[model samples]
Target chain A: MPKLINKNTVITNPWTVMKASTGPEILQVVPGKNFIVPLQFWKLYQEELNEYDGNIAVWLDSDENPEQISDELHSLPLIALNFPVFSDGRSYTNARELRQKYAFKGEIRAIGDVLRDQLYYMAQCGFDTFEIRHDQEAELCLQAFNDFETGYQSTVAEPVPLFRRR
Target chain B: MYRYDGYDHQMLADRVAQFRDQTNRYIDGKLSEIEFLPLRLQNGLYVQRLAPMLRIAVPYGMLSSTQLRKLAYIANHYDKGYAHFTTRQNIQYNWPALVDVPDLLADLAEVEMHAIQTSGNCIRNTTTDQFAGAAPDELEDSRAYCEIIRQWSSFHPEFAYLPRKFKIAVCGTVDDQAATQVHDIGIYIVKGDNDEIGFRILVGGGLGRTPVIGKEIFDFVEKKHLLTALEAILRVYNREGRRDNKYKARIKILVKETGVEEFKNKVTKEWALIKDSSLTLTDEEIDRCQKFFDAPNYQELSNTPTQLTDKLQSNILFAAWHSQNVKPHKVTGYSIVTVCFKETGVAPGDVTDRQLEQIADLSDEYSFGEIRISHKQNIVMADVRQDQLFELWKALESGAMASNNLGLLTDLICCPGGDFCALANAKSIPIAEAIQRKFDDHEELTNIGEMNLNISGCMNACGHHHVGNIGILGVDKKGEEYYQVSLGGSSKNNASLGKIIGPSFAQEEIPDVVETIVGVYKEKRIGEEKFIDTYNRIGIDPFKEKVYAKAD
Candidate 1:
């Protein structure tokens, strides 16, 4: 099983991704088990999400808006942003908007195509849990964070730049 | 030049360390080549056709003598004993082993320099006019804001990855020497109605596949709100730019698809959110950035030196060099001297370690121990004293660095095409050499006058063929190379893309076609109208008729 990483430490991955399904073939999300469903499913099956007694987590596509689902953050265990491919990076700014403006308190996870080189930037933009590809070594991904110790811009983790601190 | 503080030093040092680890990881089979590509690119290492080419950023084209010497040291030690200066004001070492790039980064860090953002699909190095601080007509010194943006954009977590590479050019001069109109983001510094200086923000302008002049989104953004406004634009592009097709991925396509007005509205909404944020430029921060770019201690020479005037009257070559290479400076008795890299037979912008060393010496002796790499791919000693110009010219001639062609036809802007670049469809340097040889006569070239001849191997437009007055694009037809000629492109204040005259030509036909174009212009031109103005008035038919008829 692939483990999630938060600040270079391995943790249990609690969410299962459910891609879009046809009519009457919707996923049977279990109660008390965190599940990550596409944004389309959340809108179509709002009744089901409300009926569930457990936590809900939604993964937003590159073009999707976080503002649509930010109101439901009180009950979510995680808000995962999807990077469909390695080159697609709209999720980076989306992650920043969620943390900086929306004040999201739950775990913000980066999933799909996540690699070791991008971990330092992911962490800086307020992502706590990274869903590394099942093919990647989770232990090796941790080393990416130790390399870059300084940053020029103010991120969610820091309110001011290093120049201001200096 | 902006001096690196302890924080800046630490940040660059940490990047070297990070890149080193990333390099080792890839070598150990821990990271795939696909996964490692962006990482290496962010460090300015490109796996080229021959070997890796490392492009190092020379921010705003300003480099101290110390920094240049270190570049020379790196060139001599790593890969070839030379470096190529790029149109974007970056220095590229065309050959380096991938294994040694991390070590190279470490050495560059010792000089407070790094290859960060030089090649990645991120906000690359911000370029300004080479005479940013020295130009007489400039409304403000733009290097201050460039330095600020450099800091804000460096290691920017959000913009570390973009759909395509983004470039920004800033110019404070009345004449757009930095080609601001053709950049992804062109910041034109100007005075507002109230005499307060601000930037005229332009977006979506680029040259690659579909060349479009950027549209202005704002007449004037206050200096304090500069960073805030830019952050909004970048956020909009980052979120909405196309990711499906790499060719259609630049912010230009997004702006064109969404329309500038709608794109402006999106950016306006984003700017509203961050207007009062910490990214807003405070007076202290602004002053701090500006202090680093303060002019050097210029000697108080009120009048032109008699010795220089005498030399100009006595020597014809010196007079010719002075007429073409010397530009008027804001500070009295100090002139901007352009040292040409476009020697007749040599590859444009390629300078050896010995030339770099010689230039370092020249900078110390003539200018204020400073140098600049222009967008036109030449070096400039922007603050050279008028009295010292004669001596400097003689010294430059001794080093074979003195060429009296600044904007002439032979002074061609060229790309490292098929010979070096992997994307090039054909070789560009040979074409440039051919054209220079055709127009080799000094007096004849002078008589022809003020033409921008540019060559590119492909539509990528690295040579900025789109804006060249007389542009050449090399196309491959059935495994053979052919050249297409375009006319009337300009990158000045009134910038426009070139128009294809007619069919393409063979390698041997380029010079003859160019000569025919010039010949037609000379015959039909009214008074002193240039080739561009003549083409604009009489249209391409006359030149087309002359060339095609000859070819047939």
Candidate 2:
């Protein structure tokens, strides 16, 4: 199981990422279990998920745009942004859009290909939780937050640019 | 020069510490090579053919004397006793041990320099005209905006992992010295209707396997909205740029495929949402950045001092160098002096550690302790006093830094090709040397004045071959190396990509091919018209016909 950092603290992960549906089939959700389903799955089965879930969240692939589910953002507890590869950073934009453009107040979690070196930047892009890759040590990744105390640009963490703040 | 305040210094130190940890992790088998590739590359470390090449970012080609000394120290201690200045106005160490890069970066941090975003798929250095603040035709200083872009792009969270590397250039003068039109995004500082300054943004311009002249996306973007506009474009690109093929991944490909109008519409839509956000620049912040680039103290001296006039009359060599290498500065008494790195037999842009130190000292003594690197891979002492021209020339001559080939055919821009780069198809420095040797005659070179002959080892166009008036691209023909020559490209305000002259040539035939092209230019010349102007008037057919006719 991948250890998770939630709100800058290491915590036991309760969410299970469900297998993505390939076709038009809607995935059935098991009751009383926290689950993170694919965006397509949530779009197809949100009505069913509303009645039978302990906690249901949607995960977006790197190519998926947050605006696709912008109307439903207020209802979701968390939105997991996937990094198919560590360097494919489209999800970073998705996270920024979810937090900034749509003004989504839910927890924005970073999942898949997440690692220690990327945590500070991921956080700056508005990700509050990280489902770090299982091969890495999560406890050690905590120090990544303290890697840079400040950034130059107007990031999600700092709304104003450094020059303005100065 | 932009001094690093406490925040800037702390951020650099933090970045150094983080990179040190990343390096240690990579060495300890905790981070795989695949995982560490982008991490190391974004930090400007490239494992080349011989060893790791570390590129140090000279922000907008502006370097302080302190930074120059530190670069010299790094080159001497960590790598070979010399470094290469790239066409992007960055300095690259051709040989540095992988283990020592972190230490070198730390040393750089002490001088407020770093290798951050010098390479990799993110936004690289934001360059500007080497004569930005000093050029006579200047509208406004573009370096301040370049500094703003530098700070914004540094470790940008969302854009750091772009599909391909991006370059932005800011041009403040009428003459596009920074080669703005060939960059990923070109920002030309233009005056508005009310005489207020704004930006003219061009997108999708780049040189690589497929070179494209950037199209104007926004005719005018207001001053405060510059960063917001940039963010909108970058965000759109980040979400939409192609990732399937590395060659097709640059924003140029996307802009070309999407059509500039449609791309502009998307950016406009995105900008509407974020234009008034906290990213908007305040007048105070803009003024703060502008203050750093304010003109140095100057004594009101004559534009052409009697000593300079006497030297020009008495010394032929100094006259030649002054004619070719010096430009009019905005200030009456000052002149911009280009220190030529294209001395014959030496690799273009390669400077010895001693020369780097010497240039540093010269910058201090002659140019107010500031040095600027032109994108043409030469150094510039941008504020030299007219009265001290002769003395400065003597100092430069003593150190062999006074090569009188500033825009001449022999002063070609050549990349560290197959000799050092892992991506090069063939060697470029040898071909450049061969051409330089053939055109060693000063009178003949002067006759074929203001030529841009650029050579690239591959289609990556690091040497900017695509925009050269005479471009040589080294192509891998099966197992053998062949050179393809292109004609009529210019990186000026009216920039265009070069057209291939004909079929490729053998390595030995490059010098002859270039000479034949020049011979045609001389024959077809109409009363001292420049090479590019002549080529444009007569087209490539005449030169192509002659070169192939000789072969036949």
For this target, which candidate reaches the highest DockQ against the unseen true structure? 2
Give the runs in model 2 whose Cα sits over 4 Å from its true position. A22-29
Measured on C-alpha atoms, candidate 1 has an lDDT of 0.88
lDDT against the true structure, each candidate: 0.88, 0.91
Docking class of 1: medium
Give residue B313's lDDT in candidate 2 (0 to 100).
98
Tell me the docking grade of candidate 2: high
Weakest lDDT window of 10 consecutive positions for candidate 2 chain A: A21-30
- Local error of candidate 1 at B78, Å? 1.3
Tell me which residue pairs clash in candidate 2: none
Q: What TM-score does model 1 achieve against the real structure?
A: 0.97
Model number with the top lDDT: 2
